[model samples]
Target: DASAMDKKQKQFDKLINEWKQKCEDITVELEASQKESRHYSTELFKLKTQYEESHEQIEALRKENKNLAEEIKV
Candidate 1:
């Protein structure tokens, strides 16, 4: 009976250690993913700003072209 109890205790300790290691691994992965998400968010904001500026410039050029065409006709 004593030997059986000892065996059971060792098995329980091994299982607990495995779970602890897994929890640590998961924590590391979560932190890395959060950092990557932040980087992507910053990149997206920069691209959106560039797109807006380009759109405004295009609209201004179109207006200028129309004015030039009208002057030519006159």
Candidate 2:
């Protein structure tokens, strides 16, 4: 009975160690995922800002062209 209990204890310890390692690995992976998410989010924001600015520029150019056309007609 004593030997069996000792063997069981050893097996339990081994399983605990394995679980601990797996938990650490998962933590590292989660941190990496968060970092990548932040990077992509910043990039997306920059692109959106650029798109808005370009749209404004196009509208301004169109208005200028219309004004010039009217001036020539006069």
Candidate 3:
């Protein structure tokens, strides 16, 4: 009976260690994912700003083109 109890205790200790290792791995992965998310978010903000500037430029060009067309017609 004593030997059987010892074996059970060892098994429990091994399982606990495995669970602790798994928790550590998950924490590391979560940190890396958060870092990547921040990087992508910054990139997205930059691209959005660039797109807005390009849109404004395009609108101005269209207005200039229309004025030129009117002059040509005159």
RMSD for each of the candidates: 1.2, 0.8, 1.3
Candidate 3 — which residues are off by over 4 angstroms? Answer: none
Q: Write the per-residue lDDT of candidate 1 for residues 1-74, one digit (tens) a residue.
A: 99999999999999999999999999999999999999999999999999999999999999999999999999
Give per-residue CA lDDT, model 3, range 1-74, as digits (tens). Answer: 99999999999999999999999999999999999999999999999999999999999999999999999999
Residue 71 alpha-carbon offset, candidate 2, angstroms: 1.2
lDDT of candidate 2 over 1-74, digit per residue (tens): 99999999999999999999999999999999999999999999999999999999999999999999999999
Instruction: Estimate the TM-score of every prediction.
Output: 0.88, 0.93, 0.86
Q: Whole-model lDDT, candidate 3?
A: 1.00
| Clashing residue pairs in candidate 3 (N, C-alpha, C atoms within 3 angstroms) | none
Candidate 2 lDDT for residue 66: 100
Question: In model 1, what are the clashing residue pairs, if there are any?
Answer: none
Ranking by TM-score: 2, 1, 3
Task: Please report, in order, the local distance difference test score of every candidate based on alpha carbons.
Answer: 1.00, 1.00, 1.00
